[model samples]
Target chain A: MDFQLSDDQRALRAGVRELLAGRFGRDRMRAALDAATGVDRALWRELGEAGFFALRLPEAEGGVGLGLPEAALLFEEAGRSLLPGPLIATHLVAGSVKGAARGEAVVAVLDAGQPVAHLGEADALLVLAPANAPRAPGGTLRDAAPVRDAAGPVRSADPFTPLWRVTDPVEAGEPLPGAGRLREEGALLAAAEQLGSAARTTEMAVQHAGAREQFGAPIGSFQAVKHLCAGMLVRAELARSAVYAAAVTADPVEIAGAKLLADDAAVRNARDCLQVHGGMGFTWESDVHLHLKRAWLRSGQWLTAAAAEEMLAGDLC
Target chain B: MDLAYTEEEQEFRARLRAWLAAVLPGLPAKPRPDDWPGRRAYDTAWQRMLYDAGYAGLHWPVDAGGRGATPTQHLIFLEETERAGAPYVGANFVGLLHAGPTIAAEGTAEQRARWLPPVLRGDEIWCQGFSEPEAGSDLAALRTRAVRDGDHYVVSGSKIWTSHAEVADWCELLVRTDPAAPRHRGISWLAMEMDAPGVTVRPLRTLAGSTEFAEMFLDEVRVPVSHRVGAENDGWRVTMVTLSFERGTAFVGEVVACRRTLAALAADARRNGRWDDPVLRRRLGRLNAEFRALWRLTQWNVSEAQRAGSGGVPGTGGSVFKLRYSHARQELYEAAAEVLGADSADLDREWVLDRLSSLSYTIAAGTSQIQRNIVAERILGLPKGR
Candidate 1:
């Protein structure tokens, strides 16, 4: 029983992290945040060209034909780089929707009851409607007619993620098969992303605690600060292990549990990271607040805490 | 990579499982038979049964009367044994796990011939005399002294937490042979007879109400210089060898046991009708996740060791595992206690005992604080504490 990644997986992870680091560093992230499009089109195209969205697509379908674990690893880098847009939605619909696999067309999903994020930028949307809802012409993106955009972008707490309330709801798109699988996949990848962010915040907290001194010593030397940093490490690692294992298992309940841990790690680490940075953390100049905001937004995305709670409760009982 | 055991490993596990199933029914059950002699008899009898099945000292070297199992096989032994809920390795632990390995690594030819077979056969129970009243985590700073008196060394000072001291026939002792040298420089490792003159053992009861440990007073107890395992004043290195064994694949049993314990905790919660409570269920789920992580982390550590082979740079990963395992186990039991509430007073003695005993996990090997320091300083390369 080996938990260590294969040599190929390690290389792939290193490649993805380096590529994301080069393309979506802090300055570029800030640029994306300030831009009207809210995403770097060039970088997005590069990701497609590099086969990011096509990772899990079958080799017969002209994709890299990797598994969910590899996809999880990629999203982890996305989370670490704080890459914006509707990532999980686009990734999930990539195989079914034309151009989505190639990353040429951005896709969004009406995420259950939540407002559809990145609606303004998405060329297509994947909606899972109830069995009683009005059916449309087709399920896949190939047959669905191009729908006109009727909603404008609404300001979101996470500037990187733009949201829009559907003013003119589309009643045409067919419901996708295995909505539960899609949610589980999304939750697993989101958990991976959360693990990345949690790990980054831990590093951030440790770095800040080392540099920020108060009483003739580094704050990290103090037990309280040391313990906080330690707690961050523990939470991040715990979530990482869970996320990685869930990716392997691909069980819905396991994924929900993984999401619960990842949510705790990401949210708590971000808050603790802000505390470690003091007043500077609250200002727009510091990126700590960006992480906290993103963590909050992501926690509510695929599997909200309450939803994950209920899923886990049902399983336990 | 793969979580399934190899075919060879599965066969080994199957065989061991069969052996355990065949013999375990005759073994004593919990509540541990209050009489001291009966308890000792039960423990030694179990060890003898294990020895007869060639299960004793399976991890030790082939030349030293062991099976010379691969690292993975050793882990399988631990896992299968624990899963079978076999008797605890109480009296023969030090002899089989620690002293035997140390003797193999450092003892002379004559020492191996004298000690190795007895340890493997459970003829001579062994206990560790490493910790002292003054030295626990800072073990190298122990002040127990052994001065030369002709062909024998007159040992003085005391050793605390000498587990199974009362029943053990021999002790793997560490003593300071030179007071003038630095703390770590003057120590020597010895194989001393527990019944040597001027030796006294007084058992110490822990919070769990078990005299699982004892303090031994040695006043001018004469031990032959020939009993020393390594060169004089080089016991620190020998102690390191023993400690390295402690940090090895022995953790497989404990990890499997922890998973079972967590499962039982979940069952208890469900039985008590608290599983429907979202908050409690969520905590249970989180605990389950943490346990899974620790399991994977252990596997990862084993894989890393395999990749590194013999001379790889030692990591602080053990400290990480220790910290996380203790935290998770403690939380699982504490959560059980909370969920049990007033019912804990009269119901489910196992939960009550486990909740109280779990606190010692953090404090036993190295306190959680010390583990964090190791992580921050050694692994993370943070500034050392003042």
Candidate 2:
């Protein structure tokens, strides 16, 4: 009944956190916000080199053989750093695609019947077919039909996450083995990211509340602001527990539960954090909005709140 | 990171479950919230049953007349007992949870011999005399006074929100022994007789129409100086120890009970056809998820204690779990009320009873406001507010 992270897990978490802090810290994230792709490829390569993309891959496959929990911890760091990219897709794809483990090939997963994320930027796209189909790949993504050049980039809520709609959709090909498992894993990892972002935003809000003074003292001295910060902390920590537990259990119901809490924490914590920063938080110069924007994007990813709720309701029934 | 209990812990749970299964049927049904007499007898019998079976004081050390179970085993005991629909420790709560541990920790040898055994055996009932009318959240500001009078302390002051005071045979009293000293420095912890001369207990009715709490008025109630748990004027630390235990595994049962309530509510929603409403479904689903997270958070804390090899006080995490559980509990009962709609007014329905009593979940132990302050100032390092 121990909940403490093993020394190895702790070291792994600290190592990922330190690496991300040094490589894709707030400053680096801000710089990438307005970049052409809104992603730091150099940092991505560095992460791949550090075995971030290969952590969950079997050691026999020339990769680090860690479990989904370890992978969740690494993605939590990514979320904390607000590292931009199709991180879960890329990491999961590395399991099937060669070169991806080395960060040489960028892979994006297209939700069945939805616009493919990183449609043009990614080197390959993997589409998940419905369960019960034959165990096979949905064809190599690079070989799939592409959208016309006239299809411009769709405006995204998060400036760091640019969306693209594909006009030329590929027909269903071969099905991947246990696509449902992959989807759950993807949701779990995304939840881990949301946990990180939630925690980071909480810290950001608390730091601002302590430093930014109004009236006669720091606004944190006021009950209203203090309660808001406290609420944010609660949301973040609750999501954290859910995320880590799901990582350990890897149960579909637990994963759905984690996604629900993580989405709430990520989105609500960012908004409350913005409120804590006041008018300055409304401006683009403030990173608080960045968190809110990213949270909005992630909430709609792999498993949305609505979808997660549906899964949990099914369990209740 | 393991959440599974040990084989020995599993065996303990199986044994407890079988015992509960066998004994629970023969016992009288649990009494209503207002059925104090019936409940007193039922609860006393249940505690004695538990004590005889070596289930009482499951978390305490063996030398202190407990099973010396690990933190995980203690949690399992709580979860399994609550899951079995057994009665709560009720009036004996203070004795088993608070005074017994305090005696073992800070009391003199004679005090332990005199006080600890009866508490485990359900032969004595205890109440806390800490909060006064003037001191609710800021408990350190308590003005309860106790002046030295040779062999005894002549205590004179009032204490509010003392649970089970009416039924309690003894009181863990906190009084100010030094009026000139700082508020937190002059306090003293004493084991006072509740039935002593010049002592008064006035039962206070709550919104639930239950007298689970009472106000204690002490007009020169003489408590032997030998009853002091610690050195004179050092009661503040002793009080802290007692309060920490109050916030400890006491909630483990509540958490399990809450999970059962949530499950029953979901079942109600389905029965009443309220589960189909997308809005209500989402709300119910979200709540189910929150409850799961809260349960996991508790497990994580217990696991942490096990990993630390420090037998579970929960420290600051206790406040976090309590605050979240309170909100979750209230929200759940409110949703149940919504599900019941007009049927919620039926007092016979258990959910209605829960809805009525849910408000106290946040108010007792420590209010949500106090909890947030602790989380902010202690957990998050937020600046203390004025």
Candidate 3:
């Protein structure tokens, strides 16, 4: 089996990394976090022009039509650079979103019963909108909702997207109540995000281990931290196999299992990465916290571990 | 990139599967062979059968009596063989796996032309005589001496952990040919008849009550100069090649088998009362995760081998695999024991012979601790730990 990435996928990842390395570097990440709107617009359009948003769209629809595997690699680079915006959600709903506006659009998967960021800022909103769930509604604000009236958006320690007040609360979408095509795609996408997050955190951990020193030596020399980093690499790579395999198969059962694995990997790797970075990881200046916060926040969104478990149990059984 | 096999490889797999299906002879219903030695011989005979059937050396070069398959084909062949639960190659274990290969690499043309074909044909067996009472992890500290006499080298001193030496036809002995040189630089490797006069083989009894390992004393066991595979004081290099092949694949078969066991154990827990224990389930979950991770590493290494030759990367992924896999293996057996409880018959019956065999994967191939050290020093570029 081929473990090497396709030339195009590799090129896509390299291109995205270059874009982020230039535009969404640490300096830009800090500025966007402090911004009132909580987004870096110029870079987002640059991504749009680069065909990042058109990854899943069919060739007939003027897009690359690559699967989640390719998308996962690109997002991993995004997480590595810690790029901003609700790119995942908008892409997830792109098939049904405004055509020409899909690339320019921004949206967030409702996090813990609240939409993250200002919903009104998006050209279109792609809310989970799970029917009949208890949540504080943002009420409709023209094309979007206005939930947060007076508040500064919180920027996670990560250099990426700043979290805004959850103004537009879409009720928890019923987990579709059944297993079919939609659940599969949703779970696979979740896995793709997790793969991105885990891979990013792993790189973060590796870099920290290499540079960070303790007692006149790189702390990575210590077996404890080495084992942790090694274990993190193991988990990230394992989940990757499942993720890539499921993407190849497009089988819901396989996808569900892979998603569960990838989710656990990202969540676990982020925590372990924080542990590896130790005090530095806890510092506000360190980017480790950003990944931890996002992993923590995302770990609960869409399919929470429990939700994925339930889906997995149903599908696998 | 296409992960699926090409047309030729698929056909190769199909043909090999069909041939194996047709030719694989039956074993005992309960496999209650007379004794360990008998079982070992049975395995040897089966290996010869496979050798004759042209499945023994799927990865060997065509010039060396192998199928001359590509690395991918070799991987497919190995995976398919494991899938078929093929028996281990018994008699030629060390010969074909180690000595013969060493000869092929460092031996003179006569040595390769003479020693390889017999071993390839399963007419001879070989055992490694590297470790001694003092040379455990510090293998270079071996004090076994082989001084040059007229036309032969008089070998002296003892070698421990000399497996299969008792029944084997020959021993691949590494000894100090020059005492004045550095510990690693003064050694020489020689292949000597196991039954040669002045050679003594005594089986070492382990706590498991089987004589799987041996201690051999060579009191002037004169090995002909023709048997010298490499230069006079350079057995260390030759021995390095022998020990190097000791690993690299990382036993993907064991990983697959353990994963199958893990799943079955989980399902068993669900059916036969133990499933409710959250602790056990959590343990299973951890093991399941570890298995997946280690298996991926194995696949990556195999892929690396497919792209690059057997000269694996200088990175410590092998060390990582050895470290993780050894612990996982011990965990798997221990978990099986836990599930079996005091009776432990189910576990025992499944692994009575293999239990002792399995312990050696870590201890024999390379100690887990040793692997960890390698990872730290070579792979991670860390300072040497005392």
Candidate 4:
């Protein structure tokens, strides 16, 4: 009945936080962002060893069989460190991926267009969404004119496209039932991602506000900064509650509600976090925009906020 | 994390529901018969019945003649009562909600014996005289003086917004005991008997066209020093206990009343023919979502309280719940008015009447601005600067 973490939960949180702090802390995240590079294979393997991606799987399958609440805690830690990878997608796939002997499988979801990996780079690309079956040239990604993305070098909003755009709009594989489609479960997943990113942004704001001084006082000591931080806290707390509640319920209506709440928090908090950092936050080096971009990406990852609300309205009928 | 109630809790709920079904008064419970004279009379009778049945003070202690129920049980009782359109507690809101709790925490053994048993018996009603004409939101600015005179405090001042002062037998009042120090530090919380000499009550007509509140004029009103709830110059702490009652576990009933309004709105929307309209549908849908969030919010708090075992005031969480509930209170009525259309204008239509009464929610209990300020300054730790 307590809303707080139990002693065991706290131990788990401490272990995960330490792991993330060592592997993907600000230094690692900054390096990766600055390099615009490939997956941190060593760190990813460590995470695998730690069973980060196997929390939800049954005990029979090399997993802890923890519920979504536990996964949610791990995911939040992942977000705080701003770890780079399709951690969410990988976890979602870990349950279903059978006979997996992998050279690092990074799962990413896409809508409208799939972001494929460099043809030689990824061992397997899990395509989230396939093009319309009614339309021709649908099963594979098409319309691929290689365009340099504003984000990292290899990551794609659409999981089918390689580091460079391919001729097809689909990833090169047999499409699953929900490659990049909206599902209540998937909606919650996307919302969780946003929740993670939003929480990071608030931390970014808080940390920066404490250290960065202006005129005479820490800008955080200023009332406006306090208000901004407070506002971010309010938004983040409510969104966290919504996401956590929905994740437990598995109700589509709650999922939509959580998605909307989390998306707003993530996007808005990221923006506010950036503003708190002033000019440095807007630059490429601060790693602030990375969170904002990730927030923007995951906000519409499974379904647009508008679409979620509309779907919720439909349920009301 | 699970939202389902325990089997025992559900059985408790069923038992309460069945009891309420058999015992609820046959007469109407709201709007028409429950408004003003008819309503007040019905409420008094019903509360007396509840006291006799040991259902009155669901949240009160066993020694105080209550059922010794958990917070969830208290919640379930209120939920069932509201669903049955049961009579509201007339003249006892202040007594049951604030005064009783304050006295229990800060009252002496003799004081508790003198005051609590009669109040629990529903033989007497109590009023709150905290708000002053000058000090509304700025409650600490109150100038109601309680000068110490031998064995008594000669209180000479006026109290505004004293609910049911003309009818209640006593008033749980806040008065200044020290003028030399700071404002709040100098105050003392007292129990003032309404029948004492040098006290006058004048009914103030409100927008509701009824004297729901009174202005009490005190001229050397003799309050025995023994009647003071706590230490001298520490009324602020005592009043804090009463205010906590409004925002903590006890506030569950009031919030349930709000959820009932939403449920009634939904039913009326379906029964009346407005269900098909897209605008109404969206409004109701949003309300439905908000209602679920609030239900979760309340349950979350209840769960924490249940887990805590020893009771205490909810700090920031209560503020969040109150703010959300107040916002939803207004929205529930607006959606109802749009559904009822022409009938929304009628005072007898409970929802419509509720639509009007809803304004008092944010204004009377705590202003929306005060809540925002509380969130701003305390809960959120945001600075409120010029």
- Taking chain B only, the TM-score of every model is 0.94, 0.96, 0.91, 0.90
How far out, in Å, is residue A81 in model 3? 2.1
Best by TM-score: 2
Indicate whether candidate 2 or candidate 4 has the larger DockQ. Answer: 2
Deviation (Å) of B126 in candidate 1: 2.1
Worst 10 residues of 1 chain B by lDDT: B306-315
What does candidate 3's lDDT look like per residue over B1-386, in tens digits? 33567798899899889877876656533233325556556666766776777776665666666666665676666667677777655556788677876887788878888887777776777888989899998899999988889889999999998777777888998889899998888988899988888999898876566777789998988899889889988898886765444233537666777777777666655766665665666566556645755655566666655665665344465666776677677787776655555545543455444454567667766686666567545654554434
User: All candidates' TM-scores?
Assistant: 0.91, 0.95, 0.84, 0.84
Give the per-residue lDDT of model 3 (tens digit) for A1-317. Answer: 65546678678778878877787788877666666345556666677666667787787887778877777676667656656577776566555555422366664544435435444355544444342232433112123344334323665433444555554434433232222344356556667777777877877776777778878888777777766666666567667766766666676546655766777788889888889888878787777777766666655555555544443333211
**Docking quality tier of model 2:** medium
Superposed by TM-score, candidate 3 places the C-alpha of residue B343 at a distance from the truth, in angstroms, of: 4.2
Candidate 1 residue-wise lDDT, B1-386, digit = tens: 55677788889988998888888787766545235556667777777787898887777778887886766677777777888888767677888888988998889999999999987776788999999999998888899999999999999999999888888899999999999998889999998899999999999998878787899999999999999999999999987776555434656777788778767777887788877676887777667666766776676666666656543235467777788888788888888876786877753467788787787889987788877887777665567765
Residue-wise C-alpha lDDT for candidate 1, range A1-317, written one tens digit per residue: 56668889889999998898788888777777667467566677788877888888889998899998898888888888888877787788777777777778787766445677777677777764421222332233312224325555567888777887665556645456544367678879999899889999988888988898888888888776777777778778768777887888787767887888888899999999898888988888888888888898889877777777666555554
Q: Residue B260, candidate 1: how far off, in angstroms?
A: 3.0
Worst ten-residue run, lDDT, model 2 chain A? A131-140
Question: DockQ (Cα-based) per candidate?
Answer: 0.44, 0.68, 0.26, 0.26
TM-score of chain A of 2: 0.92
**How well docked is model 2, in DockQ terms?**
0.68
**Model 2, span B40-113: residue lDDT tens:** 67777888898898888887777778777777887888888788888888988888887788888888889988
